[model samples]
Target: MDFKELLKELKGNLLSLMGSKFDELKDESKKDVQAFLNASKEKLERWTTLLAEGNITVSDYKWLVESQKDLVVLKGLYAAGVSKIKLGHLKNSILDTVIETAIGFVKPNKDDDNEATV
Candidate 1:
């Protein structure tokens, strides 16, 4: 896929994942998660705009990819930590699936069907 197609697909996938899976969070944590989703979406928008404006260099794309990889790591850690701390308030499996979905967008595998884990 072209860079623009990839970016649009990734953004749509992420927003969908957040919408479907974020409801698994506790009432108190919902706002925090929503805010995070909003911020991430905005960042994606900025990146898209930069690419569309021909302002993005190869180095910038490389940095963006690396940052996304870093985000996957952070998501893994957050899932683990929050799953433990929240106990019954959240479901780790759902969050894990969401993380996997997001990661797939960053480093897509044509073999995977993008199924959510139970």
Candidate 2:
């Protein structure tokens, strides 16, 4: 899987994770999302390669994503009166989207144990 393409798709998926109705949320959170993508690009590349090579599981990906929680701050949303519960949901949604999108992009390259027959 192309890392650049994966990043692009992740950006779109995360920006729309709250659905179309939350336009304000989308607009307000775009910078935060970009910031995350920028800061996480290298780490994501490594983990994605691991994912594609069957070196890591979805659970591992979730754990790695969670480790970057500090990078997902949403000052704009907080200032916009978005409740803590909703903000938490959005943050969770972002992390969930990252894992889901990575899974969708990178298929495990595991080979069959048995040899092929003619």
Candidate 3:
């Protein structure tokens, strides 16, 4: 598949995963999770469209990756924020893992680097 298609597929998968994770939260945490999911969905849509339209440069991809990383961090913070209200260690663990996995997707791969540090 082409880069745009790959990015689109990735975005879809991430959204699906985020939705599933949000569903696992208790009612009290649902609102925050929903908000996060909505924001993430919007960002993913924008990035995917830009990629598909060939409007994304290498720098844009880098920015996308960074933005995704920030989102993953936000997810983690949201999980922590709701940990008290959620009232379950298992749920907390699941949320943590989901955030970690999401972060992993956009993280820079060691093999993808071409620069040598001075």
Among the numbered candidates, top lDDT falls to 2
lDDT by residue (tens digit), candidate 1, 29-94: 444444444445556556545644446643454355346432332243255365544433233332
Candidate 3 structure quality by residue, lDDT tens digits, 62-104: 4564554334333443545645343344334434443334323
Query: For residues 1-118, what per-residue lDDT tens digits would candidate 2 score against the true structure?
Result: 7999999999989778755536767667787778888988999999989867767766676688878877878777777788888888778878878887877677533232111110
lDDT of each: 0.44, 0.75, 0.44
Tell how far residue 5 is off in model 3, in angstroms. Answer: 12
RMSD (CA, Å), each prediction:
9.3, 5.9, 8.4
Off by over 4 Å in 1: 1-8, 11-37, 68-70, 73-118
Among all windows of 10 consecutive residues in model 2, the one with the lowest summed lDDT is: 109-118
Candidate 2 segments whose C-alpha is farther than 4 A from its true place: 19-21, 108-118
Candidate numbers, best TM-score first, in rank order? 2, 3, 1
- Which 10 consecutive positions of candidate 1 have the poorest summed lDDT? 109-118
